[model samples]
Target: MRKDWCEARKNDPTPTQMYYAKNGVITPEMEYVAKVEMLKPEYIRQLVAEGKLIIPANINHINQIPMAIGRAVKCKINANIGSSALASDINEEIEKLKVCLKYGADTVMDLSTGGDLDEIRRAIIANSTVPIGTVPIYQIIHDIKDLDNLTPQIMLECIEKQAKQGVSYFTIHAGFLLKFMPLVAKRKMGIVSRGGSLMASWMMKHHKENPFYEAFDEICDICAKYDASLSLGDSLRPGCLHDASDEAQMSELAVLGELTKRAWEKNVQVMVEGPGHVPFNQIEFNMKEEQRLCHDAPFYILGPLPTDIGAGYDHITSAIGGTMAAFHGASMLCYVTPKEHLGLPNAKDVRDGIISHKIAAHAADVALGRVGAIERDHAMSDARYKFDWNKQFELALDPDKARELHDESLPQDVFKEAEFCSMCGPKFCAYKISQEIAKIECNDYPKEKK
Candidate 1:
């Protein structure tokens, strides 16, 4: 359906939604996002034109259902799934995609570093209904093998190929410059990002500036052709609490701001990726800095985990940070699963990660007072007060899990309507006693005035 929409505008120089938005045309993509976000179509278009939001609807991604990410919309979550050098297959990645969709991931990034990268991405794009993203450098380095021999042309070629394959966004690590190499010496983790580390090693070996930074204009041209948005990768993002909000991270962020403008100049949509680990106290400063530095282009961040010790439960830690990040103005939260410092995430890990970030995003929405954000919370409160178990389960983020835990105790249809669970029992139920109190009908209570 979107293919037809782009077909009609085949003669246009740029196929980007931002292009159409800047021209005062509200494309069908904007209307679709408006319906989903409960905002006016014109408002969506205005945000897109102003570079405050991004609708990553690549023209070639015909199967994609457009979604908006920005401060004006509800905070979004992204789940990363792909094959690494050791494990996972096409079928496994597909299963992960299904889990992401089922549990409310706003987007999915195919970070497959091994196996058939092209085939895996093609399968992911063909099967995905949400915007698909990738780091082209991963595939480029995987194919090239020898970092010293890698060329700018090869990098652009890989990115363009992925763009044509319906990748809705590319995480280009343009901010990691050659000058920042010395700064890593002062850090504990050094360069933690795979993309960042690769770029650093290549630059050191070749003694050249970041190819992505130098070739950014060409990359923008490619993105403009396919309407794929640019997710400026944060190569210098703090990897640990000790490194949080340091010089390396801040330096790269400044460059991200410059790249954001450069991409926007060609009418390419842009969102800047942020830090990997940030203390809770610094999340607000980091978010606000992105707004000021990037000129309000959407900010997407991974865990930004506040503490460093929650190794196994980093998902929970990140969710705690994610809430602060979103509340402070982050547009999207990339989930970190329990397997995060341990290993690759399985389908169950994916589900757990998505639910945690989903809750974080929703809580941020409620805290920010986005329209109707708290209505569901209010509904859940009412359900609990009335002892409506089924309704409570229905409103839960993970209904099956909620129902499963409830059944572990009750496990009977008779308890479906029972006024109390095993926790309180009918005799000790506060809800039951509260209802009885309402019926006391005290004569001293004030009566309605006539």
Candidate 2:
């Protein structure tokens, strides 16, 4: 370690939090995360040191509010916000970020492959208080028309640009090795990841190993310099329910597991990304297997939709699988929007996706009884039982929507506190009817001997 890096370097250039934690140095990020997770600083530091948790705050991302993802803390949700070649703009992407964060998305990834990619990332990072993640290969291939030109050097350059620009983590698909290609040959949907597919194609054309895999150490050096976490993208993730947990996906996971250890050696924080879609029954198996194979490094999984027919309602399918995955120990969920497989999402879709995953993560937390998870649910139930409309709205997952629907039918100012609403007139209200039944029992008490 350099002397200047310790004192004169604006911040402690301790390589990464994992480095400090492993060395028993509780960093500022760790202390901040301990407060948010309601855990002792030592506990947070220990788990992070052991590669069981990740605080994906890059040293350069000054505005980021530190977050914890692992088995010990509350499960986190990530929303994808970016512009495709067809729709490319900055303002709308920022709007989407606002919507996801408002609905409680723990992190956001900019998968922009169009427009001013650098500018889009800078704007999102500047406005975002939460840690931002990105895929470097998206931009490397975005500019180079032919896949032949996409080399290891270009990829590293892209990673350097984003890492220095306050990006907290990267989704590098170095796990997409050449041998896994033939395994996905028989799948229903082959290679769904844009970066993953581009990489596979590039490797096939050059008859060479994946640049990301070959140059992974160089990549680690860059990540360590900026304290960026590695999200080890699942390039071979299943695209449909039938393809879930297949040989190709498993092989990629094994590679990711190996890469996780390599990243740790470089003091780079690491997490393994999981499936695109999986059957309901296999979600638990996948989550557990990833934890076992990755040495319990934080597992971040996409919705892994349990059904393939759910086009417009993919958010529902995603939540179904996400619930089981999180319950089984997956630490982070990548939200799937209602428009999945149909079109890019708008702001409302972003809200819907995040709310759906938030429900899944919270339900899992409650099931695990982690810390203070159950209290919020109990509070909501109490509010409903007492007919506290405002309290009910406040306790709801989507408070604005809850308030709007309640006021739609019972618009009067007096109805705000009334025990009855438009759902049922006062005569049919269940709580009121129960009260009347009790009154009847009191009034009709058997008479004493006359």
Candidate 3:
């Protein structure tokens, strides 16, 4: 007779570092994360012990490159890529995933609401070297054509299936309670989150509590079994600047805080998701509020876009807010592509979004003075002053774009090392001119040779 894992592993230690850390033991995951973060394994264990940091490596995500997310680690960014009801297939979604990972997305979410959700998720998860996250309610809605008929058990089952398949984190919207539904009536853009709106709708139709909230304990058990982290979704997050930091958002945040403690109680790693759109002046406040309310369980924010008018250039807007959010205390940024507010992002949009957030996260790391964060910026400036174009390209966030743009006007091999780029065309290059001026100053001070 074969024993089930529960019985067979009864005496064996859990793979979750939190489980191990709480017991004052450091597992290999802790050791690997220590090397990746450049901190000692013992220190990593301590942070995990305090619940100040999270390492979202599911035991089944065997190929994952382990990473830590919290105040202690370098700021991280997540890229969202999945098929919508209209565009993209499994291949296209996977292609986008490749672009996201290539461009430095710390994690990826398969937000597919169309065509074979399982197939798409499985393909992405099977090939993903980074953690894959998803909103399981989407699949439940897909399976149950009638929203009114959907049951709590169905939602939990679908999510458990994914968790078992190696989803490192989940965006469960347990915070969107029925009472909060009334507050959204006054908002400019009501219920912008897909998962948030769906949960609200189910609540309204059934006249009941949010199922995810009702089943929070069970969700914790499932996530813990697989060592998956919880990214408690902010379903009431503001969709526009005017709706930001409003009562609805804060109320849900309070609930998320409660859930965070509960998830921690079971040793399930938790990170709280935050705002949709917010003004620039208020971005820091949002970060602080979430940190305080959620007890700093690694806040992950979606742009908190400073302005609403950037439909075509939301990636840039996201970068601006993302930099500030991370600098203020956010641990992870969900990349908002140029196609935001318009349509599903394509391959280029994914690449563009990842690159933008990479800039934001790195800028935040530099601002926070994370070790070795400023070295690359210093190196780039030095390369420019010395006309080391090759080194400059290497130091660029999107090196391909940097190389391509520079080569557009100066395609010659000799220009690869030249002090001037097409922007200045040798004659007007500021760095080149500075070098010439320095030579003149040296000649004028030749008496130093005597």
RMSD (CA, Å), each prediction: 2.3, 3.1, 3.5
Residue lDDT tens for model 1, 72-105: 9999999999999999599999999999998888
Superior candidate under lDDT, 2 versus 3: 2
**lDDT values, one for every candidate:** 0.93, 0.88, 0.87
lDDT of 2 by residue, 226-286 (tens): 8899999998899987888999989889899999999999889999999878888888899
After superposition of all CA atoms, the RMSD between model 1 and the true structure is: 2.3
> Using alpha carbons, what is the TM-score of model 1?
0.97
Deviation of model 2 at 24, angstroms: 1.1
Best by lDDT: 1
| Separate clash counts for every candidate | 0, 0, 0
Sorting all predicted structures by lDDT, with the top scorer first, yields: 1, 2, 3
TM-score for each candidate, following the candidate numbering = 0.97, 0.94, 0.94
Off by over 4 Å in 2: 1-13, 435-450
Worst 10-residue lDDT window, candidate 2: 1-10
- How high is the lDDT of residue 352 in model 3? 95
Report the backbone clash tally of model 1: 0
